[model samples]
Target chain A: MLPKKVKKRASLLTIFLLLSVIGVFLILNALNKNILYFNSPTDIKISQDINYNKKMRVGGMVKKNTLNINDQEIRFIITDFKNEVEVSFKGTIPNLFAEGKGVVAEGKLQDKKFFIAERILAKHDENYMPPELKNIMKENAE
Target chain B: MLNYFYNSNIFTWIEKLTNFINSIFFALLIAGLSFALVFSPPDYLQGDSVRIMYVHVPAAWISLASFSCIALLSIFNFIFKIKHLTLITKSIAPIGLMFTCIAIVTGSIWGRPTWGTFWAWDARISSMLILALFYLAFIFIHKLVSDEDRANKISSIVAAFGLINIPIIKYSVEWWSTLHQPASIKITGSSSIHSSMLMPLLLMFFVLIMYCALIFLMKYKTEIIRIKKKNLKRL
Candidate 1:
């Protein structure tokens, strides 16, 4: 077995490491609700802690057939399959924002059902493929 | 023992290694760039902009890996009083900071077309920014602190503290809904990225690792020289 000094130091180091890990875990845990960058439609719909008056973020897919575009104002419904939040924004949307694509919008919650987005950001999944392969997958899906 | 530990033999080795890396670095860089910019197919969605991943992903990865390495070494050195490891940590800190900055900038550039914002205070982005600050703190403490022993001790503790942020950065996407996309590549599970893109990305990562090696060797050699100079009058 190791000497007493080495063992003590080892235990000391272990304690410090454990404490640091636990401390960080607690800190991140406490900040979990605050550090969340955006909320899904379901989160906004369900979470009672959310302040409706404060500016916040809601993110999800641009629901199919919900995209209604006119001059200066674009209206769409963002959904995460469980709940939907209607978004109205007057800004230049990203090139990738399309119906049934992921999107993140920042605004104040007017109510649970409608959101006015000051800034709209597109979101994409991790998958990357060539257009031909993508088309084949789309065809297969259809 | 001190003299032997910092002997000239390692200097010769460093020189040769630097020369060897210099010889092959350009060829590998060219190949990696060509693969990244030309050979790899554009994403079905992002098109040519996806090329940014070749640099951004690798740089971000190296920065994370470097910080972890330094933190581990620093912990050991703080415990064991290993002088050589301190040298190694010092050499690595600048490189880590550089790559962290590169990753942040490249990621910002990639965000415009895809995410529609140059910057956001999202969990992932904010956490990475915190990482850069940690790197800065680790590096600047070394440069600004007057007492070497104190500097090393404080910096080691700082690095140990920053170690916690590593996982936070890694899991920020899944833990919190963020604008940043989740990782496409996984160490254990099957990667979502296709082989074509992955090849260039790995190639670029290899080349950048080589570049980091070159920089690290030079910095280590300089530190060795600086130490030897301090002892020159005695000799």
Candidate 2:
């Protein structure tokens, strides 16, 4: 059996190791709070005030029939299916960026609910479409 | 007996101090998000799409470093027959995998604004995807083997083999047609990024590196503790 002193030393080492890890974490946190994740649009709307100049990503689906294209400026509404945010972009649309699709727009908020997008992204699932879409086509023919 | 009490008190104090300070990962996560959110200067050309670089670059760096650790640990285990080395490597798999996922997701998000598409099977993207797959394979093999010794040997071999792809991934942009931009920060040459933007980017990278190191150390320490306990219990 190991001596009591040896056991004590081992325990102390473990404590020291753990403390060192936590110490590093705290030092970094004190320097800058970079780890805190942002909330979705719904959450952002409910909580603290957002600055007009500050940039953030607001995620949601495009509301049906809200997109209006006027030469350079393209405007649309993003809905969490509960609350909607108006998003305007002054650039060419992303290739996958279609109306009535899920999008996450990055930009600053202007007037409440108005987001002037610096960038717009389209999100899609990784998996391929099942045979169900084809099966539906066959059923429609029958 | 007196020495024991004194030592115990020291240990307790250390624990309290660590708890009070908070985790490095938490700090880094906050610093990274905030710096990226506000202070980082916009790109001269891409504008705000430049902001995505804060998250994308750090995540990619972490993924790369973690894989390097895996390769090193695998080699160590293979050469020295260290029992805990493989476990440490295995513990890092999830962290590496998560970093890779973050890199891919953030890269795709950045790509949409700049490249006009969420994805392209460009050289860099394809290589990152393959790296992620290699990590997945590591996780799968670790799960497959029942015998500890055999598992360690096989997984170490697999990890060593996976190292071959890291260079290909790094140089893919130069070797293939890619929408992904070539390296902005280069060795043997000055960085393409301007000084105004580079400072915060470097700061953010440092923060990310610290966080990754802290987490890896924590995970590795925990794995060692758990394995020791299991060995003790078995004996």
All-Cα superposition RMSD per candidate: 2.0, 21.2
Query: On residues A60-100, what C-alpha lDDT tens digit does candidate 2 reach at each position?
Result: 67888898999879999988787788989987666556666
> After TM-score superposition, what is the CA distance of residue B33 in candidate 1 from its true location, in Å?
1.1
Error of 2 at A78 (Å): 36
* Model 1 chain B poorest ten-residue lDDT run: B1-10
Candidate 1's iRMSD: 1.3
Interface RMSD of each: 1.3, 17.6
Candidate 1 lDDT over B1-235, as tens digits, reads 6556466598787888899999999999999999999999999999889999999999999999999999999888777777888899999999999999999999999999999989988888888898899999998999999899999989998998888889989988888888899999988999999898999999999999999999899899899888889899689
> Candidate 1 at A56: error in angstroms?
0.9
* Superposed model 2: Cα runs more than 4 Å off: A1-142, B1-31
For candidate 1, the docking band is medium
Show model 1 residue runs off by greater than 4 Å: A1-6, B1-8
- Overall local distance difference test of candidate 2: 0.69
